[model samples]
Target: MTKTAEAGAAPARGARAVPRSVWALGFVSMFMDISSEMVHALLPIYMVAVLGTSVLAVGLIEGIAEATASIVKVFSGALSDRIGKRKLLAVVGYGLGALTKPVFPLAGALEWLVGARFVDRIGKGIRGAPRDALVADVTPPALRGAAYGLRQTLDTIGAFTGPLLAMGLMWWTANNYRLVFWLAVIPAFVAVAVLVFCVREPTLPAAARPPKLPLRRSELVRLGAPYWRVVGIGLVFTLARFSEAFLILRAEPAGLAPMWAPAVLVVMGLAYALSAYPAGVLSDRRPRLDVLLVGLALLVAADLVLAFAPGLVGLGVGVALWGLHMGFTQGLFNALIADSAPAELRGTAFGVFHLLTGLALLLASVIAGALWDAVGFQGTFVCGAVLAALTAAGLLVLRRKA
Candidate 1:
């Protein structure tokens, strides 16, 4: 080909590549995750060992915090749609989350800890739907799955790195949990800064920027059956998988050192990060629901492994499976929501989906905590496996219907 033709083709090919905003959003997720995970890796242990809290308390705290985030997404997402401005809400959310970082180190009582977690998750809630919607808005539909996967991959990188960093700092500070919490504050601010300076919002034409609220009955009807079906899948999936706090709790009895329990998250994060991008790329080419079914099977396996494992090796295997499940499903679900909803209501779609899943998580975590107290850890995991299997069966039926 002529040099002029070749040059022209190069620009056309480049036009199909993933956009810069997606990468920036991924980094934003990464920084926030690093900040959050460092505290999370140690929070359960700190509560149980230092603050003398019960396992039930840990479960309740994690469940409530996450559920709050889920419920909050609906409002924030709707607001973003109403304003036709995603980045502003995202900035507010990230800022709130960053501000709450200091509270963790200062928390001495369960109430303080719970309050801080609640506030932080509210920040998460504020940002979650809008940020996800922003991803869909900025990227082309053809690259949606890959875009979600890229974001999930970067976020998981931070997820794993935070725990790894915490593990190192734990030893450095002689297992000082508070000091590690203090250090976590740094990344939260960085995440906000990145969001402010790096990512650009896609421009909507003046005529397209209507002042309609997503909550209207007419708007709700427009969301349709496909979107609700996705919500059903999310609800069932969330019910089968409770907070990762339970995983950390299980690690000690599985024979990990208390100081090293954070390593469990590190392992999960590694598997999640490695698999996310590949899963995203595959989903972009193949059937999304098919990829999700594989993820569901992995979750059932992970639960069974955890339910009957003999030692730390078994636990690690289970954790790795859980990570793989996350890598396979999470991004696909996001892409599905983006695909299923109208471009204008993407924020509302994510919000409703998160709200349903969040409610399920609250119930699941509470039930898991109760089971842990009543029938021991084995029983809790066995319950998870059963729910996961049920979810898998449901997905199969849905796949056929689709």
Candidate 2:
């Protein structure tokens, strides 16, 4: 069957039934996110308060680590395409991430912390593209939107729960950040165990595999205009969104205690988990671009609220909107990439898409950090709002053109 016809075909399972591998993958993602967030929730404060790092430094570290992951995805994704061994690479990636868990609690210096984060993100980079491609490979395209949404929802559940766990541990340990970090190790290993034992790779016959590197010009040409359009939109969306570290920072002005800071992410994650699946379903039923516009609108509203809000209530509203934007956009973005890319090149398509967005993210974060240092917290979010507005306008025009 033609790629389009295959994608359009009725799902192998009913509307409510997703493949076991996808569920397993979602669980793996959930456990890892739980592990990661436990650290991430406290990491900004750990840097600023314990380690004596500046906000700019925190932004730089986050941007660089994430950008490194982005760069790695291009190679890892293409390699999986060439070797036809997605599961092995994914296992290695998850193992590497799991191994890095201990480094968090043990770090005595900034270099050690940075090294741990760098290595950890590399594992993320390695697994991300192939895992995404694997989801596309196993699930019917008709169900792609919901599949991505379900995984995201599960992941967000972990994302929020980890912070809540961290908050409790922080209280129980008398704000012992290191001890919380130590406990996070448990979930990371759980994620690895699930991936290794529960998830099975779909087999592909030798003849069906692509012969050359996925990045070669001839291969990329096959990705075509629609794929490129999605890539462009992704870059713009990323430019409007910076690292969430700033949100935690924003909460401080409203009298949120350092130990309670993770509550910000908890709120965001709750909103994200609740909304992601429905947004994915909405995207599947409506025009994808329209769904994207709704997401953009939420982000713009979030930025505005964060920029002007004076107290905790406003911050809560803004953070919740930010999460809502993530819920609305992130999974749908993955589905759109799947919709546009050919089956054979899905991994590389995700890689290239992520690469550009990563670069944009680096730029956005840097700008936000600089703004925070120069003009204040308000400047940072106001800039984000303006950028989001511009991007939304541009997308509206482009959608019209199309």
Candidate 3:
């Protein structure tokens, strides 16, 4: 980084603890994730017992939601640069998501459930890139990995808490799913309130910002070769990996208890939380190739565990490993985008990355659903394991090519 770039990063730096604004941003993510995961963690039960939803429906909702977030990311990120405010949009996104929380509690039909999901994802799409861009805006270059890691750590912590909360509610209410969902609104409201008051965005150069309008030559815009390769890794990996919801859904058919749902999810979230920040800090010096390789290998091993695991203990191990691998790479993957892509295009890069990855997830889930219907849980996982291996193999090829 140049002297000027170093100067540009000054605002992001504060006292050793990280600025109150940034930590608050982490809180916002923490609480919102808690809210979303509360419902998402237990959704499998609601679908299975309450609505009698099929695997295909479960897959479709997630696939659709991710696809929605992707589209919003492309334009909203660009728009934020013009508005010169990442913080406000983030608050709006959080607020929107919170507002929709009540819908699930009121929903009586699966379609309404899907509709609530859509509204919530719309909030996600609006907030994601701008929020990330805001973090970059305020964070010093040297702390980039640590900052993103901390943010990811907090986010996954919410994932951990949300499920445990859900589990408790389920047990306490004697399986009153609706009441548990109603309680989700509290954390979400807290997240939005935090964002509104505390998080701050530092003003920076437009080049250092996400673009305000359509990119001058978007398709032709250079996303550096190394970054492009990183995106490829994400895409292939996403193709192999289905959503966590699907994983939980898959476990159910194996006779896993609904009450045990939150426990497994808690384990996965803990694995993700423990690894994300360290992975980010490590990625700063360790070379993405090396860290990425280790992560891919871990995922391959995870898939193998899932493919062959005959019971709950084995299944838990596989899920936990999968979460660990994801934590190791998830935030690092975004940091890689920041490193390799130009500042003006960071949002585009992320959006494009999500587009490909989300689309792949959509396809993977849908395809997995069909396979599950045809051949059952084990068969679907056997296929997933093969695909994960293929994704790992692709990474090795990229390493050699680079």
Write down the TM-score of every candidate: 0.95, 0.97, 0.92
Off by over 4 Å in 3: 1-20, 206-212, 216-220
Residue by residue across 1-402, what tens digits does model 3's lDDT show? Answer: 222332344444323534456577788999999999999999866887678988777777788887887777766766675566667777778889999999999998888888899889889988888888666656666666777778888999998899999999898999988899999999999998888878766665655553434445653257678777777778888877787886777577556888867777888889999998888778766777778777877787787887777788788898889889888788887777777766656666666677677778888888887787888777777777788788777778777876
| Model 1: pairs clashing at backbone N, Cα or C within 3 Å | none
Ranking according to TM-score, highest score first: 2, 1, 3
TM-score computed on alpha carbons, candidate 2: 0.97
Give me the candidate number with maximum TM-score.
Answer: 2
C-alpha lDDT score of every prediction, in listed order: 0.88, 0.89, 0.78
Task: Name the runs in model 2 displaced over 4 angstroms.
Answer: 1-9, 12-15
Residue-wise C-alpha lDDT for candidate 1, range 1-402, written one tens digit per residue: 111111222221122366777899999999999999999999899889988988887888889889999999998988888787899999999999999999999987889988989999999999999999888887767677888999999999999999999999999999888889999999999999999999988755545443567878788788899888888889889999999988988897799998888899999999999999889888888999999999989999999999898799999999999999999999999999998988777888899899889989999999999999888899899999999999999889877877
Per-residue lDDT value at 78 in model 3: 64
Could you tally the backbone clashes for each prediction?
0, 0, 1
* lDDT winner, 2 or 3: 2
- Best by lDDT, which number? 2
Scored against the true structure, residue 34 in model 1 reaches a CA lDDT of 97
